[model samples]
Target: MLHLITYKYNFIPAGEQALHIVFPEQINISENQLIQELASQLRDSYEDEITDIAPAYRTLTVYFDIRKTNYFKFSNKLKKFLVNYTLEKKNTYGRTFEIPVCYDLEFGIDLADVASFGKLSIPELIEIHSSTRYFIYMMGFLPGFAFMGNVPDQIAMARLEVPRSSIAPGSVAIAGKQAGIYPVASPGGWRILGRTPVTLYTPDNPLPPFQAGDSIKFKQITRADYEAIKELDAHGEYQLKVL
Candidate 1:
């Protein structure tokens, strides 16, 4: 049997060509999943009029071609569609990905600092961080960069006051209640917890295997395993373990 959850939402004009469907301002998984489902439904139902649909934590920004449809007409259509929308509770929502991470000091530069801030030993911090399966609220900032969330309050740390000039790719990090992995080498301020060996992004293939409405669980691994996995991944031999 499935239960139904009621949600209140509003549509706001983003610009002449785009609009936003705004929901409650919170990081709840159920709401985000609904946003994802709505995005998919809109794309399928209004592909001819809509150019793009971007789903975030609490908003779905939809862009439509003015030639085919204006904001007012589209908004009215969306309003009617939403009035009839219903989300059925499910036993499972999205795929769960197990990411292998190495928390050695060399990669996790801010490991000690974050552990200290949490008043925990390194092992305790690692255990707490890796235990939770984080939901991918959205993917932004860069390709393959997933903004996940709700880190355990005990170990949730804030971003660095000053951003780093260069952060290596595959860096697993946390900021406040959010967690993410740096898909590529880029400047970032998120507190570094560790690094993953998987190739998250590449110019040849920009789209990531994962996307919004998915789940990620980090698995702690040794440095040796990291090197071995890195080698296999580089050769396109390693496959990500997913549930």
Candidate 2:
């Protein structure tokens, strides 16, 4: 028996050529996965009409060619598609990446503050943060910035009240239940926990290796290890490990 996936969702016009399929507001793995799957299916099913599809935490923004399909026709098609959509159970899991992060004071400026907030030792805080394989709910803000989630409640710090002028690339951060990395040396604010040595983005190759629906696991490393990996990555000799 085919189990039809059903969830409450609504369509909202973004512009003349685009529209958003919005789901319930929440950061959830199952919901995000559904959005990702829907995006994939839409691309495959309506490739001629769709120019791009971006999946976020609980929304999929679809950009279609106005010449090929108007909002009313496209939305009606999407409604029909949703009525028959069923997810492939076997392909539920996304790719998993093991990224290295160093929680040294110089890189993690807000580390002590987060630890204090959680009433945990720095080591304990690092342990909790690194233990979980965070799910990638979306990728935005920068080319390689992945919005991942469900930071352990013990250290789920909120974002800084004042935005930072600039944030270094590879900075690992947490905001409430979300975790993320700075892909380049530009930012507003998110509580910094550590920094990764891997080069997340480069001008030559703007697109990231991973995509939304993937998973990221941060491995705690020493400062020396961070420097070593940084050198290797800069020279293009290092590759991020994926599981």
Q: Kindly report which residue stretches of model 2 are placed more than 4 angstroms away from their true locations once superposed.
A: 1-5, 89-92
* CA RMSD of each candidate after superposition: 1.8, 1.6
TM for candidate 1 is 0.94
How would you encode candidate 1's per-residue C-alpha lDDT over 28-113 as one tens digit per residue? Answer: 88778878888988999999999999999999999999999898899999888887777665435488999999999998899899
Alpha carbon lDDT of residue 153, candidate 1?
Answer: 89
Q: Which ten residues in a row have the lowest lDDT in candidate 2?
A: 1-10
lDDT of 1: 0.90
| Candidate 2 lDDT over residue span 1-243, tens digit each | 223345788999999999999999998888888788778889999999999999999889999999999999999999888888887543355888999999999999999999999999999999999999898889888888999988988899899999899999899999999999998988667999899999888889887788887899999999999999999998999998998
Residue 216 alpha-carbon offset, candidate 1, angstroms: 1.0
What is candidate 2's TM-score against the reference?
0.95
- Among all candidates shown, the one with the greatest lDDT: 1
Each model's lDDT comes to 0.90, 0.89
